[model samples]
Target: MTLLASLTLASCSTILNNLPGVYSIDIQQGNMIDQSMIDQIRPNMNKRQVLYIMGSPMLTDAFHPNRWDYLYSNQPGGEPRMQKKVSLFFDGDRVIGIQGDFKPSALPVIKESEETTVDLPPRDLEKTMWEKITNLFGIDDIDRSTESDRLTEPGPATSEPTINYPDDSMPR
Candidate 1:
């Protein structure tokens, strides 16, 4: 009976410790500093500029007033925790040195975004309720197209075919 009880208790402990279907949320703590933001920091930059680039530091020891520590730890669900640490040493207001997981490159890295600029045609705003009602009854006879007509010099034509959308006023 003692052997049986011991076996049952051991099984219960294992099951309780790691239950299936348990959801453990991703845990993130301290300042989230990325490589891009870290790359922006330069020596001789003042405290305010460092604050702007790296954001507020996580740990500033009272004993070490000149040193600012940026600590970040992320644990996703059941995975192992990953930590990143960056320490900036300051002489009075200006930053003198930096140390940690990331170091400053000889030339500052500038990440150029791959966003393309599209010149979209003007959007046709929906007519107001009153305007719709007036138009439905043929009470409003004012020519809307000509009222706000803007004429611009024709640019070099492109080979792409133009698409004409159906008029909103016309019933489908």
Candidate 2:
């Protein structure tokens, strides 16, 4: 009975040791305002009209009711994903101007450009298969390995450090 218990404990320890690292996910949405929609907002537009056109502002300053900000961001996955932002400014009760990191030229043009027609390299099925096999067998040298190095090393001791503070009983 003791031998069986020891074997079971050892197996459980091995299984726990081999467990993968924790992963996190953040679900993001697309921008609420597109360039075309922003373009429709013209200078000297009424505050109510602007609100009707662009919907509710994303943010408003506590002290300044005249200024309104519309902001949005998204990451579609993979390294170096694209990021976008837009801001509109208002003075008094009218929209005085619109300004942000986004440029009108950078916005998707309606015209058919030659760059859009450029052909991409055809995917090699054999290469993909080899990569999958490598990944499955843990042969890939890339950081994509499921085995986490964190568990292999000893973690810092949980003992809390002592802190000293001056006594508050003394009169000023």
lDDT of 1 by residue, 1-172 (tens): 9999999999998786578787778999999977888788888999999998888989999999999999999998857899999999999999999899987877966879899999999976788677888988888876566423534545559978876667775546
lDDT of each: 0.86, 0.67
TM-score quality measure for candidate 1? 0.57
Worst 10 residues of 2 by lDDT: 75-84
Clashing pairs in 1: none
**Clashing pairs in model 2, backbone N/Cα/C closer than 3 A:** none
Candidate 2: list runs displaced more than 4 Å: 1-26, 29-31, 78-82, 103-172
Can you tell me which runs of candidate 1 are displaced by over 4 Å? 1-22, 113-172
TM-score of each: 0.57, 0.40
TM-score of 2: 0.40
Give residue 116's lDDT in candidate 2 (0 to 100): 47
